[model samples]
Target: MDTPKIELTKDGSNTLVHPKYNAHYHSTAGAIIESDFVYIKSGLDFFIESTQTNSVSVLEIGFGSGLNAINTYRYAMEHEVFVEYIGVEKYPISLEVVQQLNFLNFFSIEDKEKVFIEMHQSIENKNLNFSEFFNFKKSFQDFSTINSLNQYDVIYFDAFAPNDQPELWTENLFSKMYASLKPNGVLVTYCAQGHARRAMQAAGFSVKRIPGPPSKRHITRAVKI
Candidate 1:
């Protein structure tokens, strides 16, 4: 696959457009808005609210530009929540390209720029918690190889659209996700297609449609019970 090109989103954050998928790495309406809304507020905050826990374990698919992870870490710091974040990605973007993106401008804190850089520079498969609230690591492999069982408190199913990457949205993949999450764990995504919901249901998840971010109608949230 060719390297993705950077584009400015509506909310002023930068995102990448995949060559093969022909889709933006995040919502074109607003990269940060979409991630913060769908993955952080809806996914992580909902989990925290339901469990009333100061610590959380999160597993994210399609770690793309690391926006969602950064947003999660930011949320953890602000809320005094400790997070163990595992980001899974198959094709890791280059550090050069990562540096070019304007994700740094999204943070008002002076240290957050360093945080973003260090996150990309950090060695893959090595858990690092240099910060007070966040422990993070990346798995640089195909999602199919992952077989974690009851390990995650929340799953950020942030892969490309169902049509763009149809293979990843299948029942088999959702079953793996169901197994990877603990009981009562929730999976949130920007997809709400009927077939995807059915596939998730077939995999034992109770699926529901929820309000999406700007420019999106509805997203999906599924739970393992």
Candidate 2:
């Protein structure tokens, strides 16, 4: 895979631009804001409130820039919630490129910066406990092949847009995601396309369209009921 070019989002956070796919790792409007809204606020926060659980297990479909992971880590620490985060990335960016990203600048805390660096440095498929509240792991494999069953409370479906990665938004792939989640597990994505929602519905999810981040009209939240 070619090295992704580091670009700054509007809010001064970094996002990667894929050379081959011609897509961005995150929204250009604001990387951190988009991740916070779609994954952290809509997915993890909603799951926590709905389940009232002290611990959360999250499965992220695309762990491109590590923005969502870092944000989730901060949320867990701030709220004293235990989180087991499993992120899947088929092609991880180089550490040098990851270092070029301006994501850590958003945090003034030394420990949070260290934790963010540790998250990128950790080996794939190896669980690294950043703290008592946060357990982090990465998988350098395709999300479609992940077969874990009934293990996650939330799914961050942060793949590229459906037009860019149509196969990932298919019913077959969502069926796998549905099977990976526990009962009533929620899957949130930045996309609110009709076909995508219908595909989730086809895979036994109760889909809902919700407000999206800046520049985006709506996002999708699907639950396995």
Prediction 1 global C-alpha lDDT: 0.89
RMSD of each: 1.1, 1.1
lDDT (Cα, tens digit) per residue for candidate 2, span 113-199:
678777787787888988889999999888789888999999999999999999999999999999999998999999999999999
Query: So what's the TM-score on candidate 2?
Result: 0.97
Please identify model 1 stretches exceeding 4 Å from their true place.
Answer: none
lDDT for each candidate structure:
0.89, 0.90
Candidate 1 backbone overlaps, count: 0
Model 2 pairs in collision = none
**Which ranges of candidate 2 are over 4 A from the true structure?**
none
